[model samples]
Target chain A: MLSELDLSAIYLTLKLASLTTLTLLIISPPLAWWLARSKLFFRPFIESLVALPLVLPPTVLGFYLLLSFSPDSYFGAFWIQLTGSGLAFSFAGLLIASVIYSLPFVVQPLQSAFVNLDKNYLEVASTLGFSPIKTFYKVVFPMTLPSFIIAGALGFAHTIGEFGVVLMIGGNIPGETQVLSITLFDHVETLQYEQAHLLSISLLIFSMSLLILIYGVLQKRQKRLNDA
Target chain B: MPNNMLKFTLCKAGLFNFAAEINLAGVCGVFGDSGAGKTSLVRALIGLDEQFIGSVNFNNNVWQDDKHFVKTEHRQIGMVFQEPRLFPHLDALGNLTLAHNKRSLYTIETLAKLLDFENLLDKKTIALSGGQKQRIAIARAILTAPQLLIMDEPLSSLDAHSRALLLPFIKRLAKQIPILYITHSMQELFYLANNMLLINDGKIEAVGDPQKLFIDPRLSLVKHAHSGLLLNVTCLSWDETHAMLQGKVDGQAIYLAMDKPVEQEILQIKVESKDVIIATQQFPHSSLQNCFTSEVEQIEQISASHILLTLNLGKQKLLAKITAKSLQQLQLKVGQSVYSYIKAVSIIGEIT
Candidate 1:
């Protein structure tokens, strides 16, 4: 398997996961905040959509996103004209799929954290002459950082290990779309047990370490709050 | 723009329900039971309750009307909650400075030092004690230098020992700033409030000088804040010779000798109205040693059987709980002269 593969696949895998994790980080905060705080008329509908990926098969999300990004749809045509290409069969396409696949992993914890944040802090902050945005930034946001870290870590690791979603959309373009999970799949299909084992073990270690780090931080917070 | 006068009639809100007309520039305490609209009134006054329909007119500045509403940030008022909601990510100093708009008159260094938060400056909020966090919360509010500040049961979360320690700090802070302090504690009524706004069941039951209300018992709810009489005491030098607490009120010396001793401290003594009796003249040869010459100010009915009698005991006003029959037999009326007998055990609290 090592002899058959080039280094570009490895680089592409790391790049795709990092970029997807970053995009989710940028998008999830306000979405989670709104879901936690807002009472808009359409909030329930929007929340159900954000939660759809959690229960749907990975391939279903990939298929829908593929259609949304293909030239046949209105958005795909408009996006293609602007970006110069349809997103399918490309690294960007795989990144988009991974972000969707990891949506619940990031949003659920972040939303709960926002909801559980000490509300009195907001009241006190408001009375202290802080604007809402300032209170969120100075009070609510920092208190939710640990949750953000958990969301980001789970999202990054989940993306690194994703298979069905990326496979459906990106189609295993050798150097552009092939990620670590795809590489591992390819090795196992070809009966290269040793290379598959190495990749699988590495992914496992990464996920476990991320979870351990989250637990450590949460334990520290519990101790501090109890002592306080 | 004018300072606001907040009027509210609240009952449906889940947290608390009450009504009052709040006039700023002085301490207006909305004292009540824990769930009895104390926090709700504060929330409404500060624009935290969205469903509330109260009008707060600050001089010429009205925060809310029937249709137009001014947001909290635009209200320019500050509040201190029972539990200090200090930002966990920020240290004490950071919490204080975050609200400083630079155009404000107050200074952070002075507030930090005054709140005794200088030592806790770099400490995380989680690292603070209950007392310390409340101090930081108050200092943070003061740093904003708002036109007015509202406090909602701010000391209820604190233990009695902690409340005792912070009362002086709060007294000092409130004097320099106009604060609406809300608490059900009797001590707050006697020690903190200059004016009282009694709210019960979402209505303005009564509003007057706290001392006067206790004497009159205008509303049934006023009993909580007015549970005891307020007697002014000037320290008369600790009686080391007798090992007792000695103080003078209205030129009459009061000696309270327990194992614990403090004689020289300016404070107020609470005399529960129930532990008092009216005598035609000063009597002797009894367990009760506290006797004062007084005149009846008024006698009012508390219940079907009990009558609340108000007497001016020299410079201090005393309340006596007497039966309706006793009042009739003695012919006690307003301005009638008599001697009031107070059992020494009725002093439940000392407000210093």
Candidate 2:
């Protein structure tokens, strides 16, 4: 029911979203843990910086990212030297933008979970001869598994739905950086109403199903916790 | 210089200034009222609170000093907090398994059976009752094979029945390892503690035998209604016909009422000061069969109408609460001998 271009766009979108979610899951935990526990004077400043993407318009963030990715900028020049190519309009550039844009969605849930964790568990683990790493794996991880799930789901869903940032930096290159949202945009611009409707309905159905599955799992977990 | 001594000098500005250089054997009861920095002292001693300036040396190992500080896990100190502190995500068995090191003092099965919580092993921690949770906590602590065990008001939050059930387990553990027991209940101090450290206003008021500390006139323990002496008596014979046991304290014969015959040779009895009757001479043909001649060592006015008399009975000491009028009528004075008639003596527990 879909054209070849549409299929390719969907593939690219899935790859980007999966990679972004994985990257965020790897990096956000320690950052969120520090944000939740650190007493540094500048911790609030760092927290606000991480939360900036949540409130800022996607275009504003995309514009700055585009500037930083250009060949003339220091960051872009360094990246070009290391990767043997320019950053703008590339899949790498788009992934970097997506990860930055979706970071707060992953970090906020984890940070709140860490903050709400009962400190007595940590103390008990310490007194029981558990090292910090063992305690985190045995105690902290199991307790916050629900938060990790929510964070991963939100990050993946948010990256899948990204539009303006991908447009500003990725620039709709076929089979390279163009994703599902930009492909749908191109269809609507070319007066292809039938195709646009098909794509939109597919996206709507897929996103609704994803959200329903996530919330259903979360509700079951919450009921189990309450019953416990 | 002893290998088992625990020495500490802890000072926290605006909170407490505590210092103790004593060797605590068996159960050392840290006794104090509320807000007397008992919990603070424990937190400092165990390396939980690092804001204090102190030196804590346990079992010849330096736990904390000016330049070096050992983390709680490396200090080999097992702790049982007031709350169970069990991990809700883990079942009771899982929680116990987390503390199972190579140096564990007992196997998980042994600890579970000893603590009487084998049925609770598979249950979720949150689903367990308060007493069940505390039993699991105690088991987990012991499985760590710690050199010293510290219980910070572990039974204060339990019901009386739970406290009764757990006290014997704690007493049993004290025989194996030295314990720092923090409690506000003087009854528990007399029942379980051989050494007592009296804490008041964040300072060590006294540290010695709990029986002697109970009768220290300068301390507030003498003012408590349940203030009494814990006397160690050796059982000689059982009078099954009268449901009484004949025991000896410092070679003086004494009688105690018991519901059943006690098989233990050494029995500790709690004699409340209110239950002791002082007389100038031995009264004959009375219901009281436990009587002894003791010399008056000290007397302190407890209130306008009541006075506490410390009587020296051979090597043992006993406290008797009497009215000031009775003291004057009997003309009781230090160095004068009097007959101490124990109205009641409750068997605390068997001391191993």
- The TM-scores, one per candidate, come to 0.82, 0.91
In candidate 2, how many Å is residue B223 off?
Answer: 1.9
List TM-score (chain A only) for every prediction.
0.90, 0.96
lDDT of 1 by residue, A90-113 (tens): 777777778878888898899999
Residue-by-residue lDDT tens digits, candidate 1, B167-227: 6666666665677888787666677677788767665667766667656544755455334
Q: Which candidate is the best by lDDT?
A: 2
For each candidate, the alpha-carbon lDDT, in order, equals: 0.74, 0.88
Fraction of true contacts retained by every candidate, in order, equals 0.78, 0.78
lDDT for each residue of candidate 2 in A52-144, tens digit (9 for 90 to 100)? 999999999999999999989999999999999998999999999999999999999999999999998889988997888898889888999
For model 1, chain A alone compared with the true chain A gives a TM-score of 0.90
Q: B1-352 in candidate 2: lDDT tens per residue?
A: 4467888899998778998876778899999889998999999998899999989998788999999899998888899999999998888998888888778768999887777788889998889989889988988899899888999988877765567667767777888888999999766776678897888999988899876777777787765633677787888888889888888998899988887887666677878899999999878989888888899998988789998898999877888999999999999999999999999888775332
Among incorrect, acceptable, medium and high, the docking class of model 1 is medium
The clash count of every prediction, one per candidate, is 11, 0
C-alpha lDDT of residue B78 in model 1: 73
What residue pairs clash in candidate 2, if any at all?
none
TM-score for chain B in model 1: 0.84
Interface RMSD of 1: 2.1
